[model samples]
Target: MIELAAIATEQRNPRSRHIDQVSTEEMVRIINREDHLAASAVEAIIPDIAKAIDLISGHLHDGGRLFYVGSGTSGRLGVLDAAECPPTYSTGPDLVQGLIAGGESAMFRAREGAEDDESLGKKDLLDKGLTEKDVVVGLSASGRTPYVIGALTFARQRGAATIAIDCSPHSPVGACSDIDLCAMTGPEVITGSTRMKAGTAQKMILNMLSTGTMIRLGKVYGNLMVDVKATNHKLEERARRIVMTASGCSRDEAIRALGQSKGQAKPAIVMLLLHISYEEAQKRLQAADGFISRTLTTASTEKGIR
Candidate 1:
């Protein structure tokens, strides 16, 4: 046996011991109370999470990629985060990726046995052409999934930066990572069902990792997703709104600037704020490394000099 008894996540919760017999409302209250612990657990690890953000952002800025690997719910969360980055930040698909144990099919269906095969983890990274310039984050709530352990091991061997997100302290998965993000969410209400508190903590940490990295990379401007890809009608409207908010322009002016910048909110904001053409806004953005604030600052300094 794998000795799961020692794992904190596998243990039962005292607060929900009689949940089966409790009233539905009481049961919900118990669950909600326990859910609060998840956020507290994540709060305790803010420093570690911030360190991970710095590591990931630095690597990405240097032309590297990020990969999230796991199985089951963990895998699904990774995929969800990676999928949102592109439309939110206007990044290419390959910039951030998610890999599940049984590949894409495992994402929709449970492949419990697939998580036990340690070799499959290594093989999956190999398929992705693992390189030193990449970063791999392994997610496993229990901190003992063989799939995640193998993936982290392979990532380290390949000289890629490795991060581990698990709910158990001093987990096996944590041992394999360069930066261990262990959020001790304790036991679940259902006992051994890590999908509850553990999942929430993982999701919160992931939100920090991806969003913080994007901010550091200049994908954001004044709390706005300036690089948002207006792929849908809603996003097109959002892009216009972002341009207007950043530049204090009328809706019509926002639309005109976006039209000139091909619906890119960042450059449109620059065009409107700096009173420059679309081409000039792009040049300034490139010169300032895609940071709207920096571009505006440089433009102000140059105008003062003139």
Candidate 2:
């Protein structure tokens, strides 16, 4: 059996040995000080994060999907990121998915015991009909969770691109992945409570991985969320603002273009910028594989166009 004491995450913090005796103010200060370590640890693995982003973008561009699988807090984090992709980037529901060890119900409540069953991980991926072109990311702070290990192994055997994010180096999940992202956010302020520093690092890393992938996929234009789905009044207003900012048009012009483009910010901006019909701008965007920049480049190159 693996010794828990040898694991950095499970090891006791020498400085926090007397945390129980500290005043509330001192406790909060100590916790805040330790929190910076998580971000620092994540900074060290940026190269790996960049590589994973590139890989994920390539597969997604080729009509593949991205999947996140984990258990407990890790699982919840995965689900949270996956759920945000649709509204944030205008991606389809099938584009990115999250699977937890104990299934969807696990997100609301803790299912710690479900993580021990390795076969459930494989079954979940199979249930989703995982394809060879898909990318599967396994998240496990301890790096030894059987559920995540099984998911990565199944992904590898099926020719899917596999990525492992963990807090421990040379983790079991990392060994099965095409790329390993180990943030090495050591022991928690409360000893073995990985929900602290380790979870923070994992969440930060997930933000980078998914946001970078979407940016690379052309969901962003000039740092603006051009592909944002205006599902609500707030988002619709934001979309109009994005069009105005991108096209340097008045609010009235942006509103007209958005109406013509059926609330799509990218095409609306393209229509305003190129003085073209909304339909033509949309066709160009589609032909350019949804890349507004590329479509604009082509439109500019066309002699006496529009």
lDDT agreement with native, every candidate: 0.94, 0.92
Candidate 2 structure, TM-score to reference: 0.97
Of candidate 2, the 10-residue stretch with the lowest lDDT total is 297-306
Residue-level lDDT of model 1, residues 121-151, one tens digit each, is: 9999999999999999999999989999999
Model 1's TM-score against the true structure: 0.99
Candidate 2's residue-wise lDDT over 1-306, tens digit each?
789987778988887788899999999988888899999999998999999999999999998999999999999999999999999998999899999989889999898899998898999999889989999999999899999998899999899999999998888999989999999988889999998999999999999999999999888998999999999999999998999999999999988888888899999988988889988888888898888899888877885575
Off by over 4 Å in 1: none
State which candidate has the highest lDDT: 1
